[model samples]
Target: MNAPNIRPDIRFVWLNVHGGTFHKLIRLHERLRDSGLSCEVLFSVGPPRGLKLGVDVPLERVPELAARGVHFLGRTEVLNRAEKSPARLTVTDAHHDPDLPRLVRGLRARGHITAQMATLLGDFCHHGAEHLLMQHPLTLFFEMDYNHTPEGRGFAQAKTIQFTGNIFFEPTANRLVNDYPDREAFCARYGFDPARPLCLWLPNSCDARSETYGQVIEAVRGAGANLVVKLHPWEYAFKKHGGEHPWGLAATTDVLWSVQAVDETDGTWAYRFCDVAMVRGSATILELPFLEKPCVMLPLKEHVALFRAQANLVRTCCAALSDMRDLPPLLKNGPPAYSPQDYEAGRKSVRIDTTRDAYEQTMDALRQILSAPEELPVFGSLAPLRRMADPFVDASLIRTLTPSRRLRYLAARALRGICG
Candidate 1:
């Protein structure tokens, strides 16, 4: 097949992820191509992506970036006017910024399409109205929780479609099926006594107390279970959060496998491997009922509310009528302050019937807001949002410094977005 002719006109944006999101973006791109829409892809770059060269620390993609014309930009980085920003291929400048509109317009005149992935949901929603409105089809794609959108006017135009790519449940799902060290091997791997039950703790990065990992470990010990701890990747162990329990207690060698590396979804695989799971910051609370595995969630966290909400959804939506009866409540209230012996009870999640009806419903809802004879209200508002002091290019500030690295990072991220 011929490579989609690179044009200044058509531009598409893709969000990069380790798994499902990547494939889905490719699928979307393919769909656009098959429809004969002239288009180009603007790949949303992440942090320092290791390429063959020195490294692409960060760069933003542009209509004109290189001999190959693949532009690179930092992901949501804040440009400090304090220092002179880098050049166009690697940095933002008056020439590129002011000239960008002409460049994009040039690409459009050349008959190319432009699309983008909104990486940060909060910032995208709160700040990205103009950018979204600039494009024809602004899709918010993820298996995100239903509440990610604020129930107000701004959301009416953007077409939000959710696909989990199993990231949300992949960790838990992998744990359920992975070939693990037999009881003895797992014990040896993590240095727990084979005779004792292992209580595994995996916390999301932001909130320590909310994840309640400390309390879970204590509870497991209180319940007489051995411990294996996998911390949230974002938590800088050396940086003390109020002198909380020092992580010196968890011997790195004794850690079996951390969800940070092992499971990007909901940390379910990590939880499934352990006899008991203590968690904070992940949405895996809903997975336990279906897996029939036991899990503990930290209170005073948002998940505390999530669990309650899930429980209510299940109890009211599917109880008695379907197998997914108990899950809603388990997700809501959390397991009793104790262990559940069997899944024979009515509460549990059934298979995730990803069928035509569901897809239709999703599309219908999206089209209600996103469909357009001209421009969709939801997406047309995000262009100005991207032009902020920081666009989607240097979002996290990881690649904002060091011109060479930033450019490379942006290029690789853009390149990774091949339409499947």
Candidate 2:
């Protein structure tokens, strides 16, 4: 089979070999290739293998990625050819995946230009400042809007962060305004009636309060509202660890199970028809106003302090039900009048603007990055040497040699102790 005959000027490199994240990048690569660009995807290995996270599992979709004309390379392969490689640009969906910064640092050390396509719309609560501040210089960030969020500011401290809007929401504006799915069909598919109020509840997996999924579903159902529950991908991982919470069950016919189907249609299919939405801390809240749906932030006690900390920003857009019992009362009056100011504020906090075409902006940014001169890789103020050596230490060669999972665990612990 011939290579996709990609243009030499633009080469896309996707990192962090995982489930849906890898697939998302593959679709983007295909979209770019069809537009006459050279693209190859490299998956992360080495230290990622030593880690115990379920997202760190072996690459499962290489055949699919290959069929899309993406060249798949492991981290070791990338390192071996770095001294003589010709791909002037590298693109990734993850900047904070633990193994990624190290590999990115290596690629930059060899003078390859790097860029990150944010997986989320700058959901600030999910990441730490170091995830941004520690990357190499000259790395470009194609975020929604860099000036609005702390992550963007942190990236600005060390890299060229662009306000390209988020590519994830590029199709959102169209969906919300003109291309929304037919309400009757959506209702029938989810066992909901078009005339009845349908509530969509999204819960994150990080909190034990997630176990409240069952309670939340029951509450909404008892309130004379039909429900659609979408569980975070990590929630399944949680159940594997013996978190036999009720939300783990495959939802029944009455409730819509829209997990991982966001890309199957226009991403906002769930939000398009729902009368009201509920969220704990998921980024899906960012889409509520655009879809003209009112959202209520369920007051999960555990996340109350976080809400209080960012209350000014969060409450501006949605009603915060101080108690779960208030669900009926809040929805009794129908969806609240959405505040344009609140919506814009929420968008800024997450670095999203539905009006802008982020996909085109991102491609333009990549082209511009390719034309620029490479900057020397910068070291952190502290532990420059150790930080420089981190990629190799976490590289696949070291972890692959460990004979067993227990040994790998001990080796990782020992490495941390020594480095500290």
Candidate 3:
């Protein structure tokens, strides 16, 4: 329960729709609530008509949150202009949400601070929305660590950007070190054979590039390993929008596929139990070294060029296989042996500094920001242009324009192709 007789003067609003990130947001909310701040979780399904990109519905946790004295705001009520209030602070784990700019502008219009607590750790260049959002004056971009948040890298110089440390990963690392669950017990709970070696297949949103997940699972099972599959929230988002259908696990093997069991929501339970892990292009591949676990990555044909260009550090960390035929041999030999140099490169790339406590530093930052006297945020270079464009291109109208969706997607694809 919340501390008795304490009222929150500062409010932290969590507006994340991704199931994976929602887990971290919940932990962050608890940390702040314990610190005596008023916390409200604003949950949503994701951008309408755009890529849904998230696997979980955050609004479902309302009753659970109410039981603990934390307030939960549904998406409709939160988005309704009639009932909206300028929160003292609004925070999110995702920048991909199309409505985020509107929400941020609304909060800042009334002199509130808006922050983006990034969910994944990687080169920020891979995420275009972050570049656009961080350029805004009222925004504060929180990085995984000091190295990730360098100065004058196209972000607003006047706004506050800090290496608040990795709130999600650091706590997860601490838990894995001090309070690890029993591997056998976890296996039993998930109905996996405790005796067999388990491999975790964590695929990102675009897993349908070369081969379907069913084909991948068949190859993994042929390697004499039990597999645990956790689809990225982005994949779920795509599925919800009537995208490609995911594979059924029963035909491949009695693979464990429970959302609660595999998703590191409560803590890093899945990684603790698995002997080896695999990914295509996930930041989680970068994090495995911190846990001292070996990871294997198989890049699809379509994404191979992009990965080669953007994911050099990730390649250094994991053993890259050409195809499914090569997986069994690698699995038989156990996780790859990384040199000291490889470990350093992976740590440096993701900025996983276990020396500092991210939760403490983040909470401290929040406290300081809230206690400081309020001032209206200074506008960035694009504020005038954004103000003029806001009325014309609001989210409500964009959602209703089904005729233009194809053109928008095509234009975006063409732009990306040209930029690349």
Q: Rank the candidates by lDDT, best first.
A: 3, 2, 1
Alpha carbon lDDT of each predicted model: 0.33, 0.48, 0.50
Pairs with backbone N, CA or C atoms under 3 Å apart (clashes), candidate 2: 46-396, 144-165
Task: Output the lDDT of residue 58, model 3.
Answer: 37
Runs of candidate 1 exceeding 4 Å displacement = 1-153, 159-167, 171-187, 204-213, 236-268, 287-292, 298-307, 310-420
Model 2 lDDT tens row, 217-292: 6676666777776555444323333344435555421233322223222235666667778887665565454455
Best by TM-score: 3
Residue 415, candidate 1: how far off, in angstroms?
Answer: 48
User: Candidate 1 lDDT (Cα, whole model)?
Assistant: 0.33
User: Tens digits of per-residue lDDT for model 3 on 1-420?
Assistant: 121222334444444455444445556668887877776554454333221222332345445665553443444544542126544655544444455556665666666565656555433321211212221111221121112233223343224444455665542522311333587766776677888887887765455343545656766677777777766554444444544434432211112322222533312667767778887766577567666667787755554543443345445667777776777777776768777677566655445343455677677666666665555243353333223223323233233223465356346435545654
219-258 per-residue lDDT for model 1 (tens digits): 5555555666655422222221223433333322113222
Weakest ten-residue segment in model 2 by summed lDDT: 133-142
Residue 293, candidate 1: C-alpha displacement in angstroms: 2.9
| Per-residue lDDT value at 322 in model 2 | 71
